[model samples]
Target: MKKILFIDRDGTLIQEPDKEIPQVDSLEEMVFLPWVISSLNMFIKKWYKLIIVTNQDWLWTELNPRENYTNINNKMFEIFAWEGVTFSHIFECPHFESDNCKCRKPKVWILWDFLSENDIDYKNSYMVWDRDTDSEFAKNIWVWFYKVIYWDDKHNWWNILEFVAG
Candidate 1:
């Protein structure tokens, strides 16, 4: 079984816009945070299988078109591919919080589904995210959690490397 690093997309990897437009709605808005590529590469070098689990509640409304979301997400993949940091899988819950979706953050269904389908060492796995929901999700699945402070200028990917390394 391989150790995995379950990560969040928005805020954790890319900076999130203001609450009014909280998502990376377009390719132009899809930008990686400082040292994110380097930090992800460090984990890759260490042989951690990366996976992305994100909640896209905005996708439920016409205000945020699904096509735009797909393009922006594809852009993220393209950017990461250039640096050789490919995720093993990416899971997203498109339902809003009110939908009570089983795959949303704070729920273990998505992670459990992945675990059942893969050879994962839960004891060695960790969750890297920027929200309390993600933290709760990690706890639900009994994995170590690291809440990346996306709002702090000092909390770059290098810091994440040191945190996991130490």
Candidate 2:
């Protein structure tokens, strides 16, 4: 059985900018939250496969071009690879909430599709996110879930890993 740790991008591992609609318009705006690097390394050493599931609905508009997202992901992957941490896959939904897309968080189609082709230990796999939609996605996929509250003093990724993976 293979264990996986699905993580949310914005507002979970990366710091969401102070905006009503949080977005990283450029690679320069891509800043990781505290303990992200250390926690990623810890999870990698623990032999957990890492996956990033995110909803970038804002990228559907011209305010944030698609290239920005690509550049951000590329730079992020490069940075993570330099630390010996790589994502098994990065799944994102570019459709807005109104689009009623099936791949978005709370739908679980992306995960379900992956599961249909992969041998995953769903009982041992977990999803770490910062929103209710993400938790719902985990529930829809029958996997464990953990919320990463950015403002909390004790909800860092390291602590979450200890509590959830224990």
Candidate 3:
């Protein structure tokens, strides 16, 4: 069985813009957090498969068009590739909170297939993210959870390494 690190995208992997609703709508808004690359590299060195599980609200709507999202997302992947960091899979829920989608965060419906097919080491696996919903997601999936404070300069995003090392 393989150990995995289920990470969030905005606010966790990259800097989430200070908007009414945080979303990486454009390339300029997709700034990466400090020490993120190194921390993720450390997890990789520990033989953990990195997977991105995120909730992107109103993704296909006119407010957050699909084309704009694709451009920024592609750029983020490109940058990560340049840094030698690659994710095993990226599962996204593009639905509004009112939509009550089964794939949204805190719900394991979307991951049911992946979980059944793959041999995952649940004990060693973890969900690293910056939201309460993410914590709930970890609980739903029966994996350990690590809450990361994105705005805290003290942590500086390097605290994630503690999970891999200790």
Give the number of the best model, judged by TM-score.
3
TM match of model 1 to true structure: 0.91
User: What's the candidate order when arranged by decreasing TM-score?
Assistant: 3, 2, 1
- Residue by residue across 1-166, what tens digits does model 2's lDDT show? 6788999999897888887778887777888877778788888888889999999886757976788788888898888789888888988888888989888888888777788888889888899988887888888878898888767868877778787665
- What are the C-alpha RMSDs, in order, of all predicted structures? 1.7, 1.5, 1.3
Residue-level lDDT of model 1, residues 1-166, one tens digit each, is 8888999999888988776858787777777877889889889898899989999886857877888888888888888989999999888888888899898888878777667778778787889888787888888877888878755765667777887764
The clash number for model 1 is 0
Where does candidate 2 stray beyond 4 Å?
none
Q: lDDT of candidate 3 vs native?
A: 0.87
Report the candidate with higher lDDT, 2 versus 3: 3
Clashing pairs in 2: none
Residue-level lDDT of model 3, residues 21-120, one tens digit each, is 7877788888998888878887888898999998888899998898998899899988888888899999999998899989998999989999999999
TM-score of 3: 0.94
Candidate 1 lowest-lDDT run of ten: 149-158
